[model samples]
Each structure stands twice: as structure tokens, then as C-alpha cells.
Target: MSDEHPEPDGRTRHYGDFYGLSEPAGEGDVTLVIGNCQAESLRIFLDGGGLRTVRTPPIHELVEADLPHLQRWLARTRLLVAQPIRDGYHGMPLGTAELAAVLPGGGRLVRVPVIRFAGLYPAHVIVRPPSDPSLVPPLVEYHDIRTIAEAAGQPLAEDALTPDLVRRVAELSLSELRRREVANDTVVASDLFAAPSFDQMRTLNHPGNPVFAALAARVRERAGVPAFTVDPGRPVLVSVHAPRERAVLDAWSLDGEPTDHWVVGGAPIDSEEVRRAHLAWYAAHPDAVAAALARHADTLRLWRAITG
Candidate 1:
């Protein structure tokens, strides 16, 4: 779904960034970052830094009808930097392999790992679509599993939100991340997120600029591209910056300041308001709650252990 939803004014976007209106027209020598939302930000970090990457709409924003447009771009792509994606994504040939197959002969295909870090926000989890609501915002779709448990009459012992608990969970997360084999040259985000002092991740799956810059350096090393010389001068991932509680920062001993309010589409929203929306949303969509509980049983079980 498109990231931007309209506000009452019809002028404000629910979230904001590139609209792809003025993106580079179909051209060869394009380095396309193909994957989820993060890929778009990674592309931003790669540009003007010495790399000549094209900014296409985020893959998720495209649908099956956009295949011809995607194919046209792929036909001209000389260096395709991609993250792993499954077959037939968005009812189109958008997967890593699927996209690589359409690349012109001699087009270079490089894979980047999908980066996810949750140690600072253990209660949050991403519940992939098929069970997700249509046109729902990612920030809203970013269900706080703890809230889900409570709304479902399974209140977590929020006490489980402790440092030692976070540490153990982080270890498991890191181990799992390390095992996911991607490109031999892929730069893993585990290091940046581990005891991060700068709030490396804006959300569980959305990382801060530093992580993208690190990945860009690695990509440039492998792709032999130049580094970004100009900064958009502001955050590229400006859609949703989730709450980073002081307690979480303290527990992780991270150096960043705490953020209680949710930043949606460049606007600050009350944390309580977001929670209320999630609770009401959970009540309205019980199937999602069930799916989340089932899909994340192990993580929930770990919390259950602490609660008991």
C-alpha cells in the first residue's frame, strides 16, 4: 500500500518522503535498491555520495499493474542492489531472483540483507500482511505485542521489559540474524543495533540514517560506486519514528535521549493516542491479534515466563 494517507486538510500526508513524480526516467547504469521500505532509504543514502542510484517508488508501493514499468527500469538497470524477497511479491515479478531474471545481460546483481533490530523495542513486532488491514498505516500496523496481549486479556507483566530480559532477547535476535545467509559481502545491522548509542533503529524494521550509510559504504565497496556527497539534510526515513522510552534507553544503556511521543509523517502524536488506536484496532480485527499471538509465540512465551 502507498505510505502516504491524507489528513483532514487533504494537504498533509500521513507520512512523507519521495513521491517518485520526478524520479529519474527509464535509463541504463541504474543501481536499484529493490526490497521493502528500508530499501528506499538505503537508496537515498547511496545517492550523491558518489553512487549513481535511481530512486524508484518503494517496492511495496507498486502493484501488479506496475510490472511493465518495473520491467522497463529493470531492462535499463546495470547494477541491481537488492534485498531478499519472495516470489510473486505484490502479484508481480518483484522478488530478488525475479527481478534479477529480467535484468539485461551483464547487469550486476548484488544482495543486501534485510535489517531488523528490536532489542530497544522488545514489545513491538511486525505482523506481515494477508492478515493485515488494507490501507492501514505501517505505524498503526506496527502492533505493540504487549498491547495485543493486554487487549486480548493476556496482559504482560510489563516488568518483563527489563534490561537482562532485553539482553537475552537481543542475543537470540542476533543469533537468528547471523544465521540468515545473504550476500557474502552483505553488512549486517546487528553491530549497529547492538547496544546502540544513537537509536540506530527508528522502529523494529526501520533503521536510522547511520545504518543506511554503513550499508551504503559496503555497497559502494562492492559495487565500486562513489559515496554520497550531498545530504537531503534531513532524515530520509521520516515517516514514523516510534517512541523510544527513557526506560528502554536506560535499560540498554544507549546514549540517545528518550522519545515518548510517536512521530507520524513528520508530525508528533501522543503516545496514548497511538495506543488507543491500536487497542481499538485490535478489537476491530481479532484475526490479526490471533495471528500475531500465534506467529510470535516464542517471543510471547519469553514474556510469559517473566510475567509468571
Candidate 2:
């Protein structure tokens, strides 16, 4: 849903550059960046460099809602910059190329590479806080996970505490900070989590990160469009813990359907008794687990070869 403003009834609010408020562009002049929350940072960067950019809603929203304003924006877009459509688990209805094919002007489409860092916190952590009593804090004095852990009287191990983890927590902390920064009396739920705090992290792309600017420049150069340019500054270095061969196999056995996050084929333990039996069996026959791991490694090697 769009906000009620002085502009036309159906137009979505243009958000970037100037804080507090933004005005819509003249007809057919907007640059539409097709992405999610990360696109906001790109919008900010583009606006700062003198480009009128607006982020399309998450892929799910666009495909489901079919909002009038969105259609209008798409029709009028001068340039379409896109990242892979990722909203939760479901695949996107269409990508930038397919979407551009339908737009009236057939705008220039620039696809950018998305560099994902292993967030200290998982996606589920944001959607659902830990259910374990030991993890939940009595009071959320600070929104950072480390602070919460300390508050819960279970400080994280030194090895577990990392810059990536801290930054990931900081990303959420920025959201929490915004929650407090805004006036509580008149704050709307949309505004509460709408824009990300650029202080801790610049863009979902991690603005200062090397990848953000590289992609932006590629869009500008390939599109042959003139826009002001500025240094993206330094990258915020953080450790990445993405799913890889070694890590994946170590955590799971080669056994059911392999989802992005889970290895379903492992030994089935439908009940507590089954689980206990499996554990006992593993203890007695440790080589079985090792053999399963070897199979997982083989699977990964084949995957890498095929994909690469």
C-alpha cells in the first residue's frame, strides 16, 4: 500500500537522497532498480550521485499485488537495473529480462551481481527469535545478539564472536535503532522497518563493499547513461560462512531431497526412540557416518564440476 501524499493518488512515494521526504519525478524519467531491501541502499547511492531511482517491491509483492502505480512506474522507467529476485523461499514470478520485455519503452536492462556474505544471524533469526529459553533475553536492552547473549548470562565463545557476526547483529541493531529513533507516538508499522539505517551498513549490498559500486558502474557504462559518480568508500570487512562443501557435509549426512538449507536425506529418526537408536547405532558404527560424509563430498565435487 502507498502512502497518502500531496502527489497523485496512485503514485508510490519516491524514497532516496533527501531524508524526511522525496518528490516523484517528471513523467518517464525514473530509473527503476528491481530488487529488495538492498535496492534501497542502491537508491540512496544513485540519488546521491544524481539519479532518480526507485526500488520495486519484493518479487512476491509485485507478482501478487499488480498495483496500478507499479505498472505505471514500469511503463515509464528509463532504465531497469536488477538483482536476482529473492524473497524468502519462493522463486520469483519473473526476472528483469522478462519484465523488461513487457514494459512499453523496452528500457535498458542492467543486471548486477549480488554478493552475499554469511550474516551472523540466519534469516530465521529475524523472522522468529530463538525459542530456546537460554537464548532469549529477559530484557532487550540492546538489540545486538552479543548483548542479548550476555544479558542471557551465556556470553558467546571467543571463536564464535566474529566481525561478520557483529556486523550482522549491527544490521539488526540499526533496525532496532530506527525503532527508537522515530517518534513512537505517530510511527507507522511500515516506517518502523521501511528504510535501513545507512550508518552501520550502507546498502544491502553493503554500500562501502567493493561489489556495490562495481555493479552500479557497470549499469551506468553499459546503459550509456550519464550520471554523477562518487566514491563508494571502503568495504566493511566481515567473515563469510556460506554453505560450502566441507561445511555442508560436516553438518549433514548424505541421505533425502537436498534443500538450500537442509540435508533431508540423512538417517530418518521420525520419533525420539528412532533418534536414540540412530545415535546409538552411530556410536557403535562411526564409520557409517564417515562413509555418508564421503558420499556428500563426492556429491559436492560433481556439483562444482557441473556448475563451474
Candidate 3:
């Protein structure tokens, strides 16, 4: 649901050099690298230097297989830039429990937290309070999964899914299912909760005779809201926030299923807000973010492998 809050004043705003490239040989210079099921690419730009392309790897090879060379390159670089694998980078926060309950029984859960970066657009940048004093000079910050994971004492697993881990995730899912049931019955149901994205609908297997039992249960727990049953005769359209609308549209254009309609939300997803909230929550409880991200990483890697 839409909640109106006073927008921050312009006077309080400060601008800084949010983007720069660093030389690979400089003492503090490190390459900012990013990769996933999509593709792997690295650029060598000296902090004062211009952009220089160094290497690019196939998306399939990078995520589905090992890239020790890439890891070594990252170890020597100054910064790492990439998206979060677990918890969403945008949209609402659907916790592990909630996601677990919603995931189709036979199908597993996949979380891909992305931070959008496209050719110097102000709106694309994420603004947040610096997590550390060292990160202060820059008004905005970009994080790499590697840096954060190391700091958290929970490094990324080469293999994300293991029997033990899967079982633990399943348990969390069950908890989410119960929680949703409670929320639906008691909490204020908002429009945001009512609108499920196309991706979400696929996860729930839209318009089916019965809604995904676990997902319905979790929705109840988190919002105490009732699940919508898609009208089988009519096409079910999925809607996404504005910021992500273009990317989502492009993706759907390439591979989206033909449906009755696909709708984009009226407002921006404002994922930066979600990230700020998550960071604050993590700051208060350090281990919590680490644990959640670890689970998220594994599932994402697995989803990539299977889908690729």
C-alpha cells in the first residue's frame, strides 16, 4: 500500500563525486567488479583515470562454475560493485519465512537483490547514511557482496545449496507461513500487498484452482491479508514499481510469457529506502544480515545454475 511521508528537503541535500575509476596498479586502487547469471565484466579505471575494459566472462560460466581468477583479481582491487543475492534490492521486504511460504512446493526460492547503475542517472543512484566513518566523504555508496560478506565473518559459499542448508531454509519457510496467517487476520492490508508482481504470480502459479497454500499462509502471517485468486478466464497481469519498470519490461520483452496484461506500478520502487532499512536493521544486529545473505546467496546461485 502507498504510504505518504514528507519528502526530504533540498537544503539538507549534499552532492559529491559519486562515480570514479581507479588504476589497477595504484596502492588503494582496486577494480569494481560485478557478475551474476547475466554476465561478468571488469573495468580497470584509475581513480583519476578514465574507463578501461579489462575482461568479460560469460554469465553461465561465472555463476554456474568457479572463477578463482576473478576472485584473486577482486582481492587485489580497491572496490567491488555488485548486487545483493538475497533479500530484494528493491520492492517490499519479503523475509525468508514469507518467501519460503510463498515458494511453490516443488520449486525452490531464489533471491536476487540488484542495485541499478545506468550511465550517470541521478535517480539510479542509491542514497543512504554511511555505515562507517571511512565511508563518509562519499555521499552515496555502492557495495560488493564480497566486501560485506568478509566483514560479516560469513564469506560466500562456493556452493550455495547443501542438504543441511536447504533443510534450515525449509524450516524458516514454515515459520513464515504461520506468520502470514496471523498478519492477514490482524494487520492493515495495503494496496502494495494486494498487488503481486508477475514474477511473484509465477511463483504462486496464478489463477490456479487453489492459490499456493504456503504462500497464502505466509501472506496471512505478514499482513493478515487475504490472497487474490487470479481470474482464470482473464489474463493476470503483474505490476512492478517504476524504477525497475524499464528493466522488467525489457526482460519480459525478451522472455516474458504472453499474458492478458502486464502492469507497471505508478511509483518508483525506491529500493534505496529498503536497503537503508536493512542496513539499519543489520547494524543493530550484525549477525542477522550475514545469516540471511548467506542463505540468499546459495539459493540465487542454485537458481542460476538450474535456469541457465
Candidate 4:
């Protein structure tokens, strides 16, 4: 690893310098593997090296044209090093699919894939040339310490903690929290859709009614959630849960006036009265309130779900 280049935003850029080395004795048999989704750039280097480049068919390309060379090198070469393109790092671990193409004829690919940061695009190197494949090092897999502690039926408090265990527990806790957030989002979305306004809009508007357009606009502004309006107007003003201001406005008519009114055309209601009215409205419309709560909860949940 080397110092990363700085981007305009003071964040480190992905591009960086990388180097590889071949064993002095096995230099003649060595073949450096390189690949890229944009294959033209790699072709220039391959031509420069005077090494023959073989492009596998589009459907067959994964490790690029380096599979055959990799197989040959693994058989004879003592050291294998690669500097893969930056964007492809996530898929570095070699899977069975890639191994099926790269391993020598009749070679039994390992079930557990090896993890290496040696810059191999889409597939990591597995070194087992001189040594028997069975003698090769065990594949590395990361696990949080909390899992181990829970499995051992041991307490995770400081009184009996190890550094590894502490770190692992922290990792596991974060992962669990992320999972919970995802579940929360699903529950919220379901609740929002259950709102009376949503149902009213669906039944009245022939699919695209804009009667509750004001509520929809408010939702877009304050709630930042997806919602539709209803037609065949009635006293029902169902809306997903929103901020206090938006909720009050939707529950009772703002009517383009600053005054708060509980009904369609009543005198301005005070802040305290507005609060009471909002509560009463929500109480009366339990389904609508639940939908609003779900709508808010879903935002947090959906984010966790995607990230986790």
C-alpha cells in the first residue's frame, strides 16, 4: 500500500501507484495478470510487454484474458503479484466460478476462497505452486467477536473482555443495528399505505385523481415520502405522519390563511388549541395516525435496509 492521492474535496482518490515483483529464478515463467472492464487500456500494456493477449468471449470473460497465463504461472512461478484496477477491488476474492476458468486442467478448486489485497481484478491469487494445494494456507474470513462470545455463552462486559472479543462484539452490534433498521423501514412503508387518505385517493380518483393534491404537495415538502391524493372529496383528510406544522395544516384547513381552524371555515385556532385539535384528529383516525408513524419510521428503516 502507498499514500493515496487527494481529490478536490480533500477525500482520497481511488487511483494510486502499485508494484509487482517476479522471483529471480522463475522470472522466465512468470506472467503478470491484469484486467479491466475498459479492456482497451490493458491492451496497450499487454502489447508493450510483448505478452500475447487473449480475450475470452464476452459471456466467458470474468478474470479477463489472464486465466490461461495465470494457470501456467501458478504451476511454475514462485511469486505471483498483481496490481488490479481501482474500481474492481470489491470482487477481488476468487469464487468457484472464476476458479473453474483459471485453475489448471483437472485441478480441484478450493471451496473457501482466499482474500488478498494484491490488486487482482475480480479474483484474488491463490498460491500453491511448489507446495501441494492441500498444504496451502487456510482462507481468511472475518467474523465479529460478539458472535464468538455469544456462541461460547460468555458475558461481553468489561469484567471478562478480551481486545479481540470487544472488537468483534462492536462489529456484530453495528451489523445487528443495521439489520433492525431495514426491518423497521418495511413496517413503516406498510403502515403508510394503510392510511385512509391513500385508500380514499385510490378509490375515488380513478387511479390518478388529484383531489388531495395539497396534501400530496405537503408530503413532498415536509414528509419527503411518496404519497398520492384522493378524489370524491369528504371530511376525511388522511395523510402520512408529518411534522407538527404540516400535520396541523393537513388535519384542518389552512385555507391560504395563517389562522388555524379545526373545521373548513372556522375562526383561527390558537397554538394550544391546534395541538389539541391535531391530537383529537389523530385519535379519531387511528389508522391514519398509524400510517403517518409508519411513514416516518420507514425512512430510517429503508436506509438501513439498503446499506446493510
Q: Find the candidate with the highest TM-score and give its number.
A: 1
Model 2 lDDT tens row, 1-308: 44654553332333321122355543335687766555645554554444566555554445444445556667766777666443332454366556667566556666553432222122112111223222221111012222223333444453453333333433544454345435322112222222322222222223343434444655666667665564646333222111122222222232223222211123322222433444444344444444333433432232233323
Per-residue lDDT of candidate 1, residues 1-308 (tens digit):
34585333321122211232345533336677887788878877776543456666667777665566577778777888888777888777777888888889988787888877667677778774356545342345587877889878988875677776666566666666666634334556566665564447777777887778787877777776655444657866667778876657777677768776877787888777878888877777777778788887888887777656
Candidate 4's TM-score = 0.17
Judged by whole-model lDDT over C-alpha atoms, candidate 1 comes out at 0.70
What lDDT does each candidate get? 0.70, 0.40, 0.31, 0.27
lDDT of candidate 3 at residue 130, scale 0 to 100:
36
Model 4 C-alpha lDDT per residue in residues 90-151, reported as the tens digit of each score = 35433324433454443322111011111100011122213222232211111112222222
Q: Candidate 4, after superposition: displacement of residue 136 in Å?
A: 32
TM per candidate:
0.82, 0.41, 0.22, 0.17
Which residue segments of model 3 deviate by more than 4 Å? 1-248, 254-269, 300-308
* Candidate 3 local lDDT, 209-264, one digit each (tens): 12222323332334222332322342222222222233333322334432222223
Q: Which candidate leads in lDDT?
A: 1
Q: What is the lDDT for 292 in model 1? A: 83
Clash counts for all predictions = 7, 2, 23, 8
Say what the RMSD of model 1 is.
5.8
Greater-lDDT candidate between 1 and 2: 1
Runs in model 1 lying further than 4 Å from the true structure: 1-28, 128-139, 182-187, 226-230, 255-257
